[model samples]
Target chain A: MENTQPATAGRQDPTALPIGILAIAGMTVFAAVFLMAESEAAVGGLLAFAAVAVLGAGKLGLLERVRAAFRDHELTMHTAIVIGALAIAWVFREDHFALLMLTMAMLYLTACLGLNVQLGYTGILNFAGSSFLGVGCYTAAVLTQHTAIPPLVILPLGGLMATIVGSVLILPVLRTRGHYAAVVTIAFAVLFKTFLEVNDSLGGPQGLAVGEMTLFGWGFNSNIEIGDFYASFYMNYFLLALVITILAFALTRRIERSWVGLNMDAVRIDELAASCFGINLARWKITAFMLGNFMIGTAGALLGMILGFIAPTNFTFADSLILLSIVLLGGMGSVWGIALASAIIVMLPEKLQLIQEYRFLLFAALVILVLRFRPNGLLPRADRIYFPGWRPR
Target chain B: MSEAILDCKGVTRRFGGLVALDTLDLQMPRGAILGLIGPNGSGKTTFFNVLTGIYGFSDGAAAFDGRDITAYSSQEVYRAGIARTFQRSRMCLPLSVFDNIMVGNHKRLDHGLWANVFARKKLRKAFEESYEEAHELVKIFDPPLAERMFEPVAGFPMIDRRRIEICRALISHPKLLLLDEPSAGMTHEETRQLMDDILEVRDRIKDLSIIIIEHEMGVIERITDRCIVLNFGRKIAEGTYQDVANDREVQEAYLGAE
Candidate 1:
């Protein structure tokens, strides 16, 4: 007799929806408190409390239960998360600095997600993430300055330009593996910075001033006033960043769940086996590299417009390391983990001004600790499950 | 044979003047199991590697399904309807059982990024079909394993992992399947069970020809319709398993010359 029972049989919990909703709400509240905290002492206290809470939840096995709940109500949980993000924006509408930091985090989230495709999914070692981002930034800067192109078209154009440049780098990357591949990207990072510094048409070391992003007739830099309600102009960029981040997240998730992700993972895990099984290693590697570069480049273009400036110093090798650390600290191959890690990496330094100068050192120390203790990452990716309700018995 | 599914002529592979495989000629009829047996360092595995395009043939010609696949890359060789397992049991261990099997299903999958992301109904249908196919293959090998399709291959025992590897090769629906030392690290009882599974798979799938590199004489005697023996990269004997077992050169190669 054929076993025809659905794999998810008897695993459904009725409380999943409420638990998922509560989890999202709790996370939103925590973000609000973390963002609004004015004193260093308050920020430190909140961090310590969060650490204790997370530890306690793990001890009580609440983490697994909550994850299961979220898995059961995936669509509902996604909707809740989007609503929570919008709520955070509304809460900080009048606070320009807070809104700016939040927007920056969203943009960084997009870029980190892009990096995750290379480092996490396909195991392509890329130490020059910021170099790719710089390509996008400069592309946006030059196009906005010289041509009459709209910012919307320029955004993806920046990504396309980055993809073209990354295609050339991939030749050397494909010829090598492991540490050698990593060195190739590192060399590219240095070469890109030096190129920007030497080239006078690209504003040299001083960089170029980017114009404001105007959609239709509305300028992204203009403050908004609705009768009695008022908000900073950064709100416009914040919303745009949110949409882009959501799209990137969805795209990354789709890739992870499909045959494309399976082929990439096969190539990542064992190239010889993948090839013997009919997987085109170079083709998939190039696909991942170009796709990741496109996302990173797109994020960079929007970031250039938001900041209204592009400089070689803004895209130094150290900046690339920061992005790499975020991918590492988040745990390679875990998209949600990358998002959480990026939030902490982006916001904590800004909140604690005392550690701003030594932020790189702090990130280095954090990554080392995570590698030694929780090697898989803060929230390691779970096993890939193709069917929604499927579970191991 | 007039209906040979795999034909290799003058296959030669050398590394820095050391011949790993000498000028070899091999042919297998359709739906026949050909056992490749040799002592350690006798170039049995090397023959498999060369055939699968892992190590390029120094000089040779191999035709599979009547198409010249001598110069094909590994990926192209697979697309040419040739699939293989590794001597050391190569698998993406972190991947699930279903995923390991689906890796071989690339020939059937729609690989377009746009289709994967936006074609929801089509992707879902493909996923369902793949899941059913993988589940059935695993069930054919081991019924209990089919239930744990989502479990990672890392946790499975060696015998089960070997079964999964064979399943991975079979999932591709190739006309020719290559099995490299499927009994490398298994007990006698496990080896017996695996051979039974292999025979069962051959019976279940029609027109499926297998080339297995095995060190176990009992397995070769039972499952193979024909046997080829190698000694120091040279073809020492060829015939039925019993005929090769009685050959003087085969005995001298396995034991020592008096």
Candidate 2:
């Protein structure tokens, strides 16, 4: 209470809190009083334990200070959330399935954000974001499999490759307007997927097995123990997630406030109006598609590294819908909303394990309920939250 | 005066074998309101589109401010300072009102991709310029328009949406402004107000020339310095509103038909 930290975010997320603090502040405050009045030692002790547990939450505040100290400054809230989520996922490495799912969700969020650059922000509604993710996945997987190049080199190359492909897909279809352009972009994605599936050299059906990347002679396979816990591989995962998430946040925020962003928002509103303003639709659309998919590709590389596998079966049209749903459910062009939506969407199926065989039905029902109740997802941005009661930040 | 600002010399367009226009010629004087009137499908909208480069003429030449704009692309035409509103007032329903006008002023943006995305000094300057221009034009509509400019246009009603469309066109400060049925859906009072605003717009910019296609007779008669009447895609009459109103063909084609 006496000392103030440079970086502190007010939170009480039901995780990492001390028993004494929670007893004095959270649910236990009233519940603890009643238990003490009853003079039941077991209930009082339980309440005291909860209070002590909640007090440990102060560490979460301390973490913000430690993170701010270590970071190169410009570590925004968006990046903090992403890094925190990735770090937590890696911390639970014993559950490989959870790691796979969370990483995939992160990648999916990146893809949706990429498409938001096309459809949500600019009103292009590109069906090619998932294809770019697939392209990126295969690009890194194939490059790493056949050659001795580092993952970082392949990472950028994957982005460039997707950008080139994105441009090629956009150029001819530039004349198509409305849903026609969307259909054409989707057709290109299907074509790309088919091209990859038919190509024998790029691992046709068997899929590509990428060799591990070595950083300064220490391969990704090399693990160093930090006390009792294995930390080397986890550090690589966190570092990758941290860097890409930072770059994505920085790039996106810059775009949101840029002239091109202004132009994109214009194009989204009215194409004829945009043209009158002298905005070159073809030029900006291509640029946006390229920038968006470039992020998708980088995230795709991260996805591949985490999973250490890539196959055509994983990337499909259904995957695009999943990403698009995340964007729509999150409120189209909102960055934080989409990212948070991705996390919830990723965790949904596991949380729905009780429904088992009817999981898809349960998922669909849950989505309907969300759409019916809160059209915007759990946390919505100021602009998209249409209710007058909600205040803008 | 000064190449007549906009000169459509013998412009003709065809839809399959149907002759929409047969070498129609018109001269729009600089900094003046030119009204276009005709029965439905009488080539009035078609003529406006041809001039705006939204539609290509089959035969004839149109020049704007001494430039041979006959072959200019839509983008080129727009870059050349030509902006127009739609007849039905098609607005980006999802975008906020201010963004609607901001989109309209898109051509004025001077930033490239790098500058735009990075918000470098150049991008900020470009946005500032456009924002200021938009801010001024939006004031004519109302005070809330400038304040609520961030609201998306699609959710706006008939009047605000129409005004937003016009403000968007005006944001770029076009040399030649085209209004396709601007007073189409307004009440008598609204039309009167709009006509006064149009006249004010002309009075403000000495270099600004406008070609307005309108169905509202009151607006056409009150605001237009010169009026052109078409029937069956032929120039039935041209002159002052009195000159066209008294023309037998024009009267029979429009007022008589109604």
Candidate 3:
């Protein structure tokens, strides 16, 4: 009676939809909204229109029909879709729009992964993620202005500083249970922001400027050339971000499959049981908190480097809410799902600039709809990777 | 007396005005099976909690293998070679069967974050070894369950869940294993099979003492070398199962006022 339902739920099917067509369709709609709209408000409205159309298509199972069309070529379709999106983004010189949207997409992707490790995998709901982001930004800002070190040295230092602060702050907070932990972290966020605002040495409320980064006199602020075409500074920054994003993704994916991840999963499921099994609860909880903050701090440093400016206002409760929304809307514990969700949430509202005024309302409606219908997000995590070809049977 | 692997001296636990485990005292030698039977609210679970450091005692001390463990935390107590199972199943339902058992091997597993990220091959090798061991143990306990090692525990039957809980405890390689009604929801045959498996486990693991709480006299009579009967947070009788069953105080405690 027990071994019936494949033992695990929420696994995403490889042949779910013709993803290449979906990506092309999604990006084409995005590009079209950017091109034809006279005003930002019109773009926002058009983007909203496109989102609704997709939702309607999903409900009607039109996506399913398209999925069935490419069932035989799933792998090829997926690869083609990815290459197509990259090619389009490369060709389009929508400098301000493409660069900012793409950079922030990767930024949010990093932050969401951090939150996923804490809240999703370890079941520690930390509302103080933005505080760690601020810590990282400030660390970089302070170090770059005061020290002779390159951005490479300063960046990881920022993460280390955030880890130190986050580890100390979470100790007292982790003593509490689920909702209490949330409240404690929320208080910590408020305290961090307030400290930054009141302290005159840290530039008071006007904020600080982070110097342009260089690696051994190779200025990141300057544009680089490849073959014939000269890449923009933002594009260079985007490439740098892409490298970091891949590293972060690979590291987190590895951790997810490791024994430490399994231990955290145990603690998340049942704290008492995990304890009885000889798992140190505080140790694992702290590992999740500190490591999560470290990644988040790196994302913050990236944000600071790209903007070349820092402010207390940049890392706020609203930013924390958005970060949390990325985790929730993405689906907990699904890394790639979070990356996709981050891109959609960050880029969609900006591209559809028509509804900028009603952006929150639109986002709220979107989140509610996602939770209502696809509670597990667009891509749920797969259970195990089966390579049946190599099996003895 | 000093050979006792687990020793409790005047252990007391109070929740407000109510004393849950009142000045309880017990001792067990290595490789011995001690059955603790009491009516509901007689502090059987409370004593277990105090011993495992889940609940702090109001007074008195508990020692495990000559070390004072009264103030130790649950994890500390476990690392000191103690493990327990809940009266109700506490399986991590979403995790795979291999993972659930592997969790019990966490203490022995390579747990350093850097090791997990950088030294993955070594960690994976260690994990594979543990997984194989867990698989072997599962095969010995229940062969059918070993086949579903990769499946999630959510769909396992009640009996299998119970078996996995015991297996989880055993994987820790504890000196003292605390079983809280392992046969709570099982049929008569299932209970007998569980008892046999418990004895088999005791036979396999060297010097592996067990403290089991059971309501069924037959289980206590058949499995326990000695029994302690509790009533109203106080032990009223202690001896062999027949001796405790024949005692007037133990009889009155179970049957109630007449």
Order the numbered candidates by lDDT, best leading. 1, 3, 2
Name every residue pair that clashes in candidate 1. Answer: none
The Cα RMSD of model 1 versus the native structure comes to: 2.8
Residue A274 deviation, candidate 1, in Å? 0.5
Question: Which of the predicted structures, 2 or 3, would earn the higher TM-score when compared with the native?
Answer: 3
Model 1 regions lying over 4 Å from their true place: A1-10, A387-393
For this target, which candidate reaches the highest DockQ against the unseen true structure? 1
Best by lDDT: 1
In Å, what is the interface RMSD of model 2? 6.1
* TM-score of each model, paired residue for residue: 0.97, 0.80, 0.87
Whichever of 1 and 2 has more lDDT, that candidate is: 1
lDDT of 1 by residue, B1-118 (tens): 4599999998999999899999889999999999999899989889888888889999989988888889888888888888888888998998888899999888999999899878
Per-candidate DockQ versus the true complex?
A: 0.75, 0.33, 0.51
Ranking according to TM-score, highest score first: 1, 3, 2
Model 2 segments more than 4 A misplaced? A1-100, A175-177, A185-194, A213-218, A222-224, A228-232, A354-393
Please report, as a residue range, the 10-residue window in candidate 3 chain A with the lowest summed lDDT.
Answer: A384-393
Alpha carbon deviation, residue A155, candidate 2 (Å): 1.2
